[model samples]
Target: MNYWILSIEAIMNTFSIIESKSDIRFKMSLDSTSERGNILDEQSINAGDKILVFIDKPVGEIRYMLEVTGVDHTHLVLHKSYETGYGLTMRKMQQVDEETYNLLESNNHRQLHQISEASFNTLFSHMFEDFSNRYEVKTEQPVIHETKEDYVAPEKNPQDEHLPHNWIVFGAPGTGKSYQIDQQRKTYFGSNYERVTFHPNFSYGQFVGAYKPRPMKEDKSKITYDLVAGPLLRTVTKAMNHPERNYVLIIEEINRANTAAVFGDIFQLLDRNEDGKSEYNIVASEEVKEYIESQTDADLVNYEIHLPSNLYIWATMNTSDQGVFPLDSAFKRRFDFEFISINASEEKIGDIDITIKGIGTMKWNHFRRTLNDYLLQHVRNIKEDKLIGPFFIKKTDLEASDKHFQKVFQNKLLMYLAEDILKTDKTKLFKYPSFSQIVTAYIEDEENVFSDAFTEALAEQE
Candidate 1:
């Protein structure tokens, strides 16, 4: 039986056809379909006839071997190999007589078609423009580069689908744990975060919203409730106004305070599921209410509270505190705990220096080599906790005219690490001088070609 060309959709009606090739050599009209019209460009085409199929949805040209099972004035039945035949499938087809077949078969058809001059040129202009567009279109792909400066914010790619209500960051004093908190606050909370360092005697009322008693007439005149909104309540109020922003409440040295005692009723807010804005009242059982009421002459029945969605907490701790108790398992599970490891100087020292220096020089690549050399020798020491943060040497605040930078290194950075570096026995470990002394040498090391004039200015300031 002669092969016929049929669409895959024609498989409902059974008929077999020769294998069809998919490569199209001729320009095919892509607008036609079996429902609209199935007539090929040429009429009366026989089996083994090289024919083009226009595929419209994706708009592409495909070639197939055509086999005619039957024909009529309005339609023709053809078969293709990949699909089974549809018997007497209706389609508009053009007849390809022997002479017309010869004209298409010979390569000279191009020369003859080209002679159609304006008509052929117009057709090709549109075809080429379409083909060029399709060929030129580009697919998007993600690029990942391995570099020291590749810092991606956690919120930009948070582990959870939603941001955490409370977060705690803990590590050694100089491990840059607080740095992450500051950055996250800047990123998520922008200007809304309120940070406070918790101390041993810090009160629950100080952390949570509390009524501050104002001085009354003769100390017994009247009691006025001064609502002092703590970091938690302040963040809650800030987040309520700025729902788009994630308002962060940062507690530095969280272990310094009695977490359970300090949090008190606000501890209920730490439940991640509560999310701070629930309207329901948590009814305390009568027995518990009666017990609490008996102990404190206060009505302790139902507690009406609303949780805010925008409030988040970040706490930083120093693990060296033996006096501080471990966080309760219930409280710990509600938070995602990420332990910020101490610096691996090899990984951080040189890179941080280069980053700071590049900022100083305004050249992105400047100081890379110098920074790398400094860290290559110091990474092991830092990993062993023998070295303080290397960022101390690369202080960029010296260049800044703002009081903020001056205060950041002093208030935050120095308090955490200056003593650590000064205390390190570098002579016993690396046969080197003290960190500050070496830094002094570097500032005075004008003979060094890489050292900038600004170095001398900073050294003078020291």
Candidate 2:
């Protein structure tokens, strides 16, 4: 049976009603009648598919599991309300398997929690207490036999679906580039990806493979060094063995380390052909060759290995990060860079009260928007990179008292301003003579006083 993924937006109104009433029926609008022409149509939704229901922001979680029982032009009905909450703008839906569902559930329903056909079948089989009603069982089988003559699976668009083998997501800090990669990892690799963060001291041995000391089994006092493969080598080996499935290796803050030094000879493998396979299949060093042979059962007589076409290497870079190791043109040419821009969505946090020490209770979203706007207009040389993302301050952070706000400002906002924004011209940026004075004014003054101070500073500059 074919599987699909579907999403639905659950607004507050619908979510509250469903939670209290236990109603499983909802309306799902189709683009046109032709869109629902046949069960086999590209846009046609069918019964027995699994659903991962998502609620609106502030309520951001998969609240329900639903099995589609029926679908019509105006509405879709579920056989059982596995979970609850439906309200708002749009919901993402997808077909998944029992394995995938279990994996998703284990991850706190955080990532890919879409329903699978296998899960639906299991849900359907045990739904009834007794099997005496044979006729009822026969009638309820969700086999889709109808097919339209014009129905065809849509052609894959390279720009939309296909990701380059080596790509870098570059953006201002907190622009959700890593979040995007995390979501894509769930979509493509499921739970089978390795993530590593690069730092100033990261080395080739730590990345590719390294010989580490371990105590000998025979003698407690004696120790032996063993070659252990790092994230890159392990992921590469896994990809080589399972060529049919895609494997991903995510390098977070790739520019934080010396790119050339961290990669060493493995850098050559970044050069790929049109088909995405490594162009120069280089032989391994004797140490690495022997290590590979010893570690795996697969024969490697030639001592040569190439990065498989299915192995995806993804990295993230912050535009404003300081002391980034530069990548040469040859290394840079191998990657496709996608820039993430600042999001201007006016999403606010709800159901929580956050009161700063000197400031009265205020909406977290309003405070963020106000601060960002003030910084942009008043602070000299401030850019989008210096602004904070909407999700930077989470719900949990607001649960605490003034301490949370203080910690956030000192660690995140003030640090950014000091290191990046006010480094060159502190006097031009703020009314205060020093960074400490500006921070003191921000903390000690009332909310309105602080805002007015910023405005007065801007006015003085004008």
Candidate 3:
């Protein structure tokens, strides 16, 4: 395993954010998908590497250390924060911990620097520590259901929360339905879930398996067609091969694609038996059977695909998008659904405020609630679905600065209102008749860019 030190500079508030939220983010010169001449792939840093976090300020020192659970472009998310970490002085580390000192000295002012694994192990005295990737085997432990109603599991992790066999979380845009799924799944299970987003062109062949052309191993000029597995098939194969464990399949934007066409005959397998196994089996074609055989070492069984009881499929549906396929009653019946209100994810927005130097400053939540209220009362034919959620803009963007907030507000919210929500009657929502006027008002007007009624509503609320 590789080790690295991530130096956090600039912005004092982010340290508390990272520590309180137990998630770290760093701006990198190169993205996760970027490639260079020196490293493997585009980024040398990967998911399994250990990271030593250093706070850059009056006294530069390494504080907490954590494992990189994921590498999302410029962000490095961990399973959880290192929790309680003692601050270590560079001088002490240099004398006592030479491995860490070497990396710190050679970092050369770079944000990220590789360190020796020996230095990492010397910092901690845990026995189960090794490079075996503990996150893999422990990710999302599935609770296997038995035919007996009272069948109890012998060994259960206390943190493991039982999940629904077939479930869907639906909500308006930015309502944190996906965030809810992600956070809850990580808490109940390990941080080892795979998610797939459906789009207009997403097809069954892409979701499941299909025969595709490939170059012959011995002859570059010759071609052959073989069955290739998709995300669902790969996940299902893994779950089926290891039935003792539970698995989860997360589908985002379930209605973006033609659900009926995408699921095809596999829809029959959505019905589950009492034990969570699929009530019916999908008849596997010869190529599918061959592919399954080649991919897995499962014991002898018929050439059929079935959903095991331990396999759970959870999906998210956005209720506020256009040009999206509708889920039929028959398809919808297979899963239980939960709806998230716009206010459900309000805490994420916090009490941060937006301020303009020459104009006025308003609490972020106050602005959101006031705007939503005004929209509901004043905007003709505008539904709650069209109203902005608590998380329409992230907390960071809200606190970025007056200019940045103004630009973001003008570019995103105002544009959304003019084009999408208030297109029926622009005068009902925005102060300006034209889009450019609306943007210009946000940039220059001191009274605010929203309709007079919205502005008055904000005043009354404040």
Q: How well does candidate 2 score on lDDT at residue 181?
A: 86
Worst 10 residues of 3 by lDDT: 127-136
Candidate 2 per-residue lDDT, tens place, 213-297, comes to: 3446677455444555678888877766666667778999999877876777778899988777899877785666765666556
For candidate 1, what is the total of clashing residue pairs? 24
Residue-wise lDDT of candidate 1 within 98-169, one digit each (tens)? Answer: 232232334211111111234223322332233333343222211222134653332442223465666777
Q: Which TM-score value belongs to model 3?
A: 0.63
Residue 183 lDDT in candidate 1: 77
Q: In lDDT terms, which candidate is top?
A: 3
TM-score of each: 0.39, 0.58, 0.63
Give lDDT tens digits, candidate 3, residues 251-357. Answer: 99999887876676778999998778899887765555666777677543776788877677889987678878889999999998998897885876677878743
Off by over 4 Å in 3: 1-162, 219-223, 299-302, 356-359, 444-447
Give the range where candidate 1 is weakest over 10 consecutive residues by summed lDDT.
Answer: 84-93
User: What does the lDDT read for residue 429 in candidate 3?
Assistant: 67
Per-model root-mean-square deviation over C-alphas: 30.0, 24.9, 18.3
Q: What are the runs in model 1 whose C-alpha is more than 4 Å off?
A: 1-161, 213-225, 240-245, 274-302, 321-325, 344-387, 392-462
